[model samples]
Target: MALPCAREVFTSIFKTGAVTKKFCGQLKQLGKVCNDAFVKKTLEDPIYKNLSESAIAKKSRKTWNTCASVIDISPSSSA
Candidate 1:
């Protein structure tokens, strides 16, 4: 049921700004986490759902300034 690694991955995506070798190593450690806890619960968390949705949504920003605002807010809340 351990979930710290999963949380670390999501946070690192924002914190590191890109996936690195360390990030991949962190993913490998997720095998230590139970499938039900990591897959069935954490990934299904509402906050994760919202973050995934926002990231994939094809939204057109009306202005340059507004684009920065949306990018700024999403990962902060997600992580």
Candidate 2:
């Protein structure tokens, strides 16, 4: 993924924001393996030490599935 797209995704996951459709395309291109790996690595962060790993994993799966569905039904855009 491009740096900006990656940053957007990181913010959406760890902070307060949503990933734009443009970045969704990038994430789709990267595929689930990369996405899961990203989440797995994030689970190692100290900030998430107190959080439940299973909960985070479940949420991450939901995010990925939502993005997948959105990209599937929506027309592709240049933005």
- lDDT at 72, model 2: 86
Off by over 4 Å in 1: 1-8, 12-16, 32-39, 48-79
For candidate 2, the per-residue lDDT at 31 reads: 81
Candidate 1 global CA lDDT score:
0.34
Report residue 50 deviation for candidate 2 (angstroms).
2.2
Top-TM-score structure, candidate number: 2
Candidate 2 lDDT over residue span 13-65, tens digit each? 66556778888889899887787789779879998788777766666666666
Worst lDDT window (10 residues) for model 2? 70-79
- In order, the Cα lDDT scores of the candidates are 0.34, 0.74
